[model samples]
Every structure is written in structure tokens, then in C-alpha cells.
Target: MTQEKYYFENPKSSIRSLTEDEIEAAIADYENGVKISEICQKYPKLKVSSFYKQLPYKLNQEKCEYCNNQIYTKVRKNGYGNDLAKLCIYCNHDYTKNCNCEQCFHNTNVALEEKRKELQIVWKNFYTEYYNLNYTLNDISIFDEIYLVLLIQSYKGTFENTLDFSYFKQLRFQVHASSHEYYSVINNLIDRKILIPNIYYFDSYDYIYSSEPSLPTINSTKINWIPNIIKTSGTLLSVSELDKILKERTYSVEDKKILWREVYWSEIKSYIDYQINI
Candidate 1:
């Protein structure tokens, strides 16, 4: 058995487990008079998988040496003599580790699954926005998605409109991660054209606003690619019109970079027209 603790802190149940002898006794009681629910309530540490190991009707089946759970085999041995019942999913060896944590139902595997589901909702909205703009995201891992969410939240909506490379290093990484992670994502963003490092830093003030040798008077918004312009219309668009329509939608350097766009020539034309009108 693996002796290392499976929990970060004290687990929900401290007892090791109900012994096989105790389980057999319980099964005997269940057959005589005791209810199955009462037996389960009495031995809360006994998992359903473990309980099934003691069922009398099941024949010729062996208990997993590690966890003592029933190994229900369908197909026989493979070419290498490996059977489907060779290993339990949780404990992958002959001996099982002791993990009576609150979850196995508050365990790491279940917690991560739940967290992944939560993140799906968040990423769904993010991807849905890009889908309108003819962009998409590839298969990203759960851990990366978690880190991305944390990174974006740290920015507090400042990067949503603008992909300012100057400040990517400033935001706090959630789990004490190194600055290299942010820098890596930044470089990728630049490659994706999500972060035009100094899109707003043009020296030609004459081209921006009239009668000022300085930058245009801007608000708290970050300037993003107009969202869903192609999905909304096939006609040519002006930059001024795009700005008006997509003023409310914004993209941070990170958000835009994560999106993978499938470019349409017509959409590109509209975008070029918008830029030309600007």
C-alpha cells in the first residue's frame, strides 16, 4: 500500500476501512434481517464498489488485491495476459493506498471534474463571442483554462479592450506561478495578432485626432477587434461604424490570443475597408 497521505489536511473519515471479515458479517446480517441501507449507514467508509465484492451471487470473480473491490471480467486475457479486471481505476497496483478522504465523493478527482464543468460555462461565453467573429479555440487543457481564468480576473477588465504588452508582467499569477507563464502567453498573443504591442502608440498624431500633437482622448475601454461583425452583416463596414456597434464588446490581449480564427476572405475585405476608412 502507498503510505503517503492522499489528503492535504485531515480527511473526512480517519478510520482505515471496514475489514473484509466485518463486511462478510454485515452481508450475513443483511441476508438474515438487517436492511442494506442500515448496513451502509453503519459502515459509511465502505464504498459501493467494496460492498459489491461481498455479494454471494457473483461467482468465479476475484477481488482487486489493492482495494478489495470486485473485479467483474467480461473479456478474457489479452495477448500479454492482461485482463480488464487487472487493476482498479483508483489504485493501479496490487496494493491500494489508504484514501478515506471526504470526497473519493470531496476527493481531488471529483473536485477537478466539478471545477472543469464550472470553467466550461466561462469558456463557452468566451468562445461564443469569438465564434461570431469567425474565431475559435482549440482543445485546451483544464489546468491551462484555470490559469487563464485566474490571469484574466487579476487584470480586472483593464486588458479586455486593449492588449498592452507593457503591463502583462504586472498582474499577479494566482498560484505563485513564475512570470514566464505570462510572458509565454504574451509572445503567443503577438503571433496571433491579438496584441498589437503599440497599436495606440503611433507617433503620427495628425492621423488620429484633429488639431493635437498627442494621442486621442480615450476612455477606460480597451480597443478590441470588432466582435461578430461578419456574422451580423456581409456588407462593407466603416471603422467609425464598427467602433459604434462594438463599443461595448472588448478583448484583452490574453482573450484574443487564445482564440483561433478561421478567416473568411469577405470578412477580411470588410476589415480592410474598416481600416481604410479609419
Candidate 2:
């Protein structure tokens, strides 16, 4: 008979992982303000040394210029431990209490962007294949995730959200997604109960106030959560302005009409704001 050889564990060593009690005790001490160095001294055999080693920069901590205490900062690109500390954690928190400081704002933005990236990873495989789908859920990129949020904000009713295909088409270019791929993902979401089909409204610009009306109503909320923020070329387009541009331009001359539908998103606000500045 052949003896068993385990793949993940070392065959030569008799050591096994730490017990639940020991792991919990270590975590309790670390979270209560014990230094990593001290934790290593106590838990050398627990294999926490590797984790501490990866965070070498955090070890050097900077002293707050005002409070004269050690602080850790993630925004600073400098080596973790060697980062120049302008303020300790306490002082920094107090200063940004109002959230007006540029440093704090930048740091907050950094954090939001990190979260978006993290979500992108989470959404990477959220789609399923139980329904005979060709694409997997992980195909979702950062853009799709952002658009889902925008769609939620744009929805006006209790049951579902709606946007004209044309309006979505304009956005497709910015995110580098084609219409086929976009609809495929959307249909998948709908199948999953993540979306619902609302009553159909015309998306054409010419319908105006007539029985067949199609007007574009873009959302005007500036999405501060967008991390770097994406701005359209012009200011926000109001109903009146959209009507004027639609008539003035050749949009009416085409054989097929591109109607406007209501939409809620950052571009709606950002566009109007940009035009106002001009």
C-alpha cells in the first residue's frame, strides 16, 4: 500500500495550522493597538511573519507634524514606513472633520476609486451560466458596474428603470462597449431579476409634446462617486436646448428618427454645468 501525500501541506513537517483559539487571540491583540513587531514576537510559529513582511513600508510610520505622533497614510506614494507625515491619524481626522481640505478630499477620492476597482473584481463573475449563457458574469468591466448605478439613479418609478436605446448608444462609445454586447449583458441582468422591463416610451427627439413624444431628460446629479469623473464634451442639454439643436441640426432629415428618452446620470448634470460656465 502507498502512503498519502498531501499537495497543499508539507509532507516532511508534522506541523498543522494554528487552532481557532490561538488565531482569535492574535487578532484581538493586533486590533487593540499592538504593534506588528510585537505580534511577530508572540506569533512567530503562527506564520503571521509573512504578512508583516509584505507591509515593510507601514513599519516606518511618520510623525504628525502638528501632534508629533506616528501616522499611516495610503495616498502618499512614498515608501510606507518612510512617508513624510504632515499629521498623525488623530490630527488628520480632526482637520478633515469638515471634509474641505484638499488632502482629505484626494484621499477620499483614492478610497472611492479603490472601492470601484474592488467592485469591478466582485462583479467580474456575478453573471451565471445556468440559463445557457455564452458569456460568464466575470465579463462585467468597471464601466458596466458604473452604468448599473446610473441606471438605478435614473429610474423614476417603483418597479423598474428605463433609458432609450439611442441614449445608451451615445454612452457606449465612452465605455468601449458595442450595442450587441451591451444588450446581451443587459438581457442577462433582466433574466436574473436584476432589471425589469418598464413601459416603453419613445426615445425620438422630434416627438416633443405630440401624441408621439420623445424627449431626452438627462440626470443632472454630478456623480462625485465616479472617482476620476467622466465629462461629456458640452454642458448639460435641457429639453428646450435639445429641441432647438435637434431642429437646427439634420437629425430631422434622416430616414429613421433618433428619439430622445429620459435618462438620469452624471453627464446630464455635468453637461448642463459645463455649458453654463461657457
Candidate 3:
């Protein structure tokens, strides 16, 4: 009599629940290169991430060829699953165990060659413009040329057009220059208005005497040294304008910046090579 009490619930499935047949159809569509969004529309109950998680076991479990780890089964119709599972996220889609077949090697070299030629053209054009801008200043020293190129390269290569002032100290070591010579060269560039601070104009004396103002003397309220982020302010082609001018020749400002970065980085290394032993 106690066991006779029973409850009946509705037979409708939850929003996340999918029948086996629906899952099978979704998997078939995904394997055939259908977009995940399209599949989600076809089966409204599907969650992309959850559905993707289930993909690892959808077909027979297979080991990753590169990492030797168990992952999703392969699909011959399209290698989307294989690419998702095997490609290294950190390496820009390069396989962990890179393929060394002749085709792969040839493809890699051809891509590099094309990139090199493109960068060479960019360098030549920019160098011509840079030279034209500073041609009036005949006193441009070799160190000035090298330092300007390095600064442009760093501004374009780094995440932001900003760096710690101490970075120049590290560059001095890299280029085998003394502290005195390094600061002298920096001052020279600053005097020529090529390198300008990205921060507000401040006098070092304010930080040196940060004490409260007395009857006769006034001092800054701040106590810490202000950090400086240097920017390239070229006489002919400022860092801001360089990318804009180059954008006409490239895909975008970002792509042009990358090409400029590559060219200047190579130029910096070449300068370092010659200056290292001298």
C-alpha cells in the first residue's frame, strides 16, 4: 500500500538534452564541413562547447598523431576535427611535430621568400623617405642611424609604442656601448627631436625635492620618479604617419606596421652584428 503512491512527470526533454538520432545527424553534418552555427540552428538544443566536448568521443576514440594523446576521431571528408585537435595554439596553426615532406618544405620556403621580398621593398621605400627627411642634417652619426632604426623597430614590434627607459641600458649592452656613450647618443636624438617622451613634460628637480612648500620654496607633491615612454618623432616620417603612408601599399595599417617592424628588426640585428666587436 505504501509503494502504490506514484508520480508521473512530463515526457518533454530539457533544453540541453538531445536524442541519439539528432546527435548522429549533427556529427555527420559537422564532419561534412557544416558550420557549427548552422548545426546549432538545425538542432536548437545543442550547445556548441558542450557539443564540441562530446565530439572527442562521437566516433571511435583516436590518438593525436602529433601529441600521442587521445582525442576526437578523424574525419576523411574534412580534416576540421584533426586540425582542431592537432594544431598547436601557440604556434599559429603549425603542427607540433611539423610535417617534413617535400611539399611542406617547399611551401614553407616559398612563403618565406615571398615575405622577404615584400619586406625588402618596404625597407627600401621607407629608408628613401627617412633619408630625404633627415638629409638636411648632415651631422647624423652612424650611432644615430642605428639607434633610430632600433627605436622604430621596438615601437612597431612591442605590444605598445612604450617601453621602460631601462630598455636602452639593455640595448647599450647588446650593442657593446658604454653608459656615457649611450646617454650621449640618446641626448643627441632627443635634441634632434627624433625621440620624444610619451609622458607629460616634467622637471627632475620636482621629484628630487618633493618636500612640502615652505615660506620661500615650492616643490611638487609627488615623491616618485615619473616613468618615460619614448615615441619616434621623425623629422620626415613620424611613427604616426609612417604606418598611414604605408597603408596605401599594404592590406592594412597593421599589416604595413608588421612589414616595417620586420625590416627594421633585421636592420637592428645587422647594426648590432657590426658594432658588437668594434
Top lDDT prediction, candidate number: 3
Give the range of the ten consecutive residues with the poorest summed lDDT in model 1. 5-14
**Positional deviation of residue 102's Cα in model 3 after best superposition, in angstroms:** 31
Candidate 1 lDDT (Cα, whole model)? 0.38
**Model 2 lDDT tens row, 112-141:** 676555443332223122212322223333
Report the lDDT tens digits of candidate 3 across residue range 1-278: 12111111222322226666765676678777799788888887766654454442322234444444333332333544354433221122334346554445667778767655554454444434433333322344333444554455443423233323335444542312332233354444543444433322222333222233221111212211111222244334444343343333325577556657766775787688668869
**Model 3: residues with Cα > 4 Å off, grouped in runs:** 1-16, 48-54, 59-278
Could you give the C-alpha RMSD of every candidate to the true structure, in order shown? Answer: 21.4, 22.6, 23.4
Per-residue C-alpha lDDT of model 1 across residues 112-200, encoded as one tens digit per residue: 56655554444444434533333222333222334334433444233344223234446552211332222345333323433222233
lDDT of 2 at 192: 45
TM-score of each: 0.20, 0.20, 0.24
Top TM-score model: 3
Error of 1 at 136 (Å): 2.0
Ranked by TM-score from best down, the candidates are: 3, 2, 1
Q: What C-alpha lDDT values do all the predictions have?
A: 0.38, 0.36, 0.42
RMSD of 1: 21.4
lDDT for position 140 in model 2: 35
